[model samples]
Each structure stands twice: as C-alpha cells, then as structure tokens.
Target chain A: MIIGEQKPFEEIWEMVKGHKQLTVFGCNTCVAVCHQGGNKEAEIMASLLRMRATQEGLEIDIKNGGIERQCEHPFFESAKALLDQSEAVLSLACGIGVQFVAEKYMNTPVYPALNTTFLGDVKQDGFFTEKCQACGDCVLGVTGGVCPVSRCCKRLFNGPCGGSSNGKCEISKDIDCAWQLVVDRLQALGKMDDYEKLVPIKDWSKDRAGGPRSFKLEDF
Target chain B: MAIDAEKIEQPKSPEKVRDVPADWKANIIAFACHYCAFAAADLAGVMRLSYPSNVKVVRLPCTGKLDQIYLLRAFERGVDGVFAAG
Candidate 1:
C-alpha cells in the first residue's frame, strides 16, 4: 500500500497559521488503510484543531472533508463545497493525493498533514512491515517469499551476511535474518539446490535511471 | 375523606437536580483500533471506569484498515464526528 504517516500538529499549524478558514481533507485509499487520514481520522484532527484554536483564542474556521481517493480528480472534486469555503487546505492523503489537491484547487493553498512513507504492509496490529524498496526489480519469485530488498537491513542480494548472528540480523535483534528464512523455506520445499544458481547483477538502467517510469497497455 | 387519610403527613418538597439544564446530547462515533485502543477500552470497562455514555464504538482491526469512502459515508449518514482512539 502507499504507506504514510500523519505530520506533526505543530508543523501543520505553522502552515495554516495566517489562514482564517481551513479545510481538513483526508484520503480514503492508501492513507486510510494506515489510519493517517480517513473520514473519522479527519474529524478527530478537526476536533483537535478546534480545541487548539479555541484555547489560543484564534477564530479559525475548520471544515472537515475527505474523498474516496485523493489521487483521482473526481474524488477530490466531491469535496468542492467544503474546499471552496476554505482559505487553505490541509491534506491528510499521501504525497500524491496532497499534490493532486494542490493542483486542482489552485486558488486555495494546500498544506500536507502527513509525512509520506514508502510502500509497506501491516505487520500485526500497529506495526507496519516495509516490504518492497520499489527498486523496480521483481525478484520475490527467486527469494522464496522473503524480500531481501526490504527485510534485510543491509539489503543483501546474495546469501547470509557475516553480521547475521543466531537467526537474527545484527542490525536489530527483533529482525530475523531474511536470508535464513528464505533458505529454510527453500530447503523445506527441496529447492535448496537452486541456491547454487547465482543471479546476475541487476541492471539499474531499466529501473528508474531515466526518472519516473510509466507503462501503458491497450485495452483488450 | 376517610378517617385514615387525615392521619397522613405531607411529604417534603423535591430539590432540583440541576443548576443548569443538561447540555445537548452528544453523538459520538469512535473508530477504535482492535489492538491497543480496543484493549484499553475493555480494560477501562473492567476497572469500572466511568466515561460519557454518548460514544458509539465501531471496532476495526487497525487505524490502517479505515477507508476514505467509509469515513465520508458515515458523515453522509449524519454522524457528527469520527474519532480514532488508538
């Protein structure tokens, strides 16, 4: 998912300090999954802003709204009424969503309420596990489900590094050796013999060396 | 009137329960995380802690699980606020 986190309140306040009217917009897609910005989250943030403004004796108008997907123009347009009333917008979406809002609402200054994090998946409950580094390589098939690109603190491509102690990575005891898990899984599946097949050096040229990558496919 | 009714004494007057009328009812909808926040609420209940009874809780696995459509949809249905306790 598009992993992200809420920006500190102090920073957000600084952005909208001079604005009399504000719109707090949340995203429903990636940011919502991680609980940074959703409808309820937006409301909580709005209430906090309300309380803070009240305490500060600041007459700031706060209107809360969120869209289905902030990256898409259609979803953000749904919040037009609330957005139109605001002098500035505080977006709780991912960087993409925030940018989209800024681009669409040219008149209103858009500020971000969350820091954009990389692609990640939920670990258990509160912990989010970072998976892909977005290195533009698809190597999970050869790694036995363990992603060395992300799981390895050092991002090792080959076998276990010298820093591996017991079954854990030396960088952090909480992190298990990704390669060890990969080897174990492969061994159990009688594919350990494939380890001898070394992979060729990755060509970064195809990755993002040309800047942002885009792909298009004609409709079937 | 019967003779038994004459023996009854007058009751004392009742006192007012409020100096000011109770405030308007607060409609609270909280989307709580199943991990920490939900456990905390359960603990509060078990400890007999008192809180405003106006809260309506909707438990979710994580704050991450919430979707934008769901949040907006609730307000479209007239929910006053959405809270993330976790």
Candidate 2:
C-alpha cells in the first residue's frame, strides 16, 4: 500500500475556486489500502470540499471519480467522460497517479491533493521502515536474508565498519549492526559458508542506470 | 434554428413561499462501481435497510473510470459525502 498525506483543506480550496468545474479523483489500490484516498476517503473529501466552496460563495462544480488505480491506463480511461466536463482535476492518489492523470488528460489541468510518502514496510501498528532501496540488484543470499542495502546505514557489503559496536551500528545505538545481524542469522542457520563465498564488485550500470525498466510477459 | 435572444437568457426562479422545515435534507452522492459497491447498496435497498435519507447513489461500470473532478463538483453543488467501490 502507498502511504500518503492529505493536502491541507485551505490549499485544496484555492485550486477549486479558480475553476468553474473540477473533478476529485480517488485510487483504491495503494492509497486506499493505507486509508488515504479510497472510496471512503473520496466521499469525505468531496463532502468537505463542497461545503468549503459554499462557504466561500464560489459557484464551483466538483465531481468524484474513484478508480482501482490512477497509475494504470485502463483505470485512468474510466475518467475520460468526467474529464470532458471539468476544467481541472484534483487527484487524491500518489505522485505517480497524479502525473499519470495529467499525462492522460491533456486539456484538463491535474493537481495533486495528496503527498506521496516513502516506500517502506509496516512492521507493526503505526511503525514502518525502509527495507529495500530497489537498487535493481538483489543479494540477500550472502547476507543471510538481512538486507544490508536497507538495514545497514553504510550499505556495506563486506565487513562491518568501525561503526559496528555492541552489535549495533554507530549511526544509532538502537539499530542493530546489519553485518552482525547477518552473521548471527547465518550462524544460527549453519550457513556462514555462504558469506565466505566472495562477491565481485557491483555493477552500477545494472542498478537503475538503464532507467525505469519493466518486462511484460504475455504468458505467466 | 432554435429559440434565440431573450429565450436563451431566460432564468428559472421559483416563487417565494413561507419558511418550512426540510427534515434536514442532505445530498449525499455515491460514485459506486457497477461490480461491487453498487451491488451491495442495491442489496441494501432490496432488503429495505434504511440508512441516512440524505444519500444519493450513482452507479458506474467501474470505479476506475471516475474523474476526480466529478467528486469535487458534487461537493461544490452541496453534496454531503461520496462513496465508491471497484
């Protein structure tokens, strides 16, 4: 699920006031799962926006369009008819969805109503941390499942640096040393030999250098 | 040709009347996908399960197609809230 923050009501008011017609969009995928801009959120925002418009003495027309995901083309197409009537759109999806809407709806002005937050894992209620950098190359085997790229402050693949102290990283006393954690896990699993196998220098070109990449498989 | 001039400029205004209670009329709009939420609401109606009378639901083929502007417009037109499903 995508984590996002709602835009200030005052800021949203400014955008809708200038336009005679507007559309408020919602995505039910990531943002919805995170409880930001889903069907329920769409209704709430629309209700509040309308009230605010009335209070401001503005003759604005706002509509709501909740789709599965704004980033996907097939889903964005669902909004085509609504775009016909509106001069502007206030998207409640993540940054990508906002851009996708603008990219698809050429004549209609698209505005982001939510700030996209980081890509992280929800470890527990109300707590989360980054677990992967999406560096393109995955090397979890040697690290015994503990991702140094994510857990390590230095992203060191070799030995733990001088920062490794008391089984914690020098960056923070509370954070466990990534290498130490890796070693302990490997030892527990009797797989320390996996680390003994030397890994060659990482190819930076292989990591995101090729730009945003994807592979489409017609068949699974 | 259709009517022109003053005809196009005509206004629609109702005659003033005495104040009357409206039972706190609220205009709630629901942008429901035809697949799920709409069906559930339909079932709600079929069962005669009464909810807040203010809600007005509009069904769509899919929630994916709703333009964000429509939602904002509902509120602009004094709608209370909206809901969707896909």
- Give the number of the best model, judged by lDDT: 1
- lDDT (Cα, 0-100) at A70 in candidate 1: 88
Q: What 10-residue stretch in candidate 2 chain A is worst by lDDT?
A: A125-134
> Candidate 1 lDDT, tens digit per residue, B1-86?
57446435454223335565488665678888999898888889999997787788888999898866566566645566788777
Q: Which ten residues in a row have the lowest lDDT in candidate 2 chain B?
A: B6-15
Model 2: TM-score, first chain = 0.81
Can you tell me the CAPRI class of model 1?
incorrect
Docking class of 2: incorrect
Superposition TM-score, candidate 2 onto the true structure: 0.63
DockQ of 2: 0.06
The local distance difference test score of each candidate is 0.79, 0.78
Worst 10 residues of 1 chain B by lDDT: B7-16
Candidate 1 regions exceeding 4 Å error are B1-86
lDDT of 1 at A141: 82
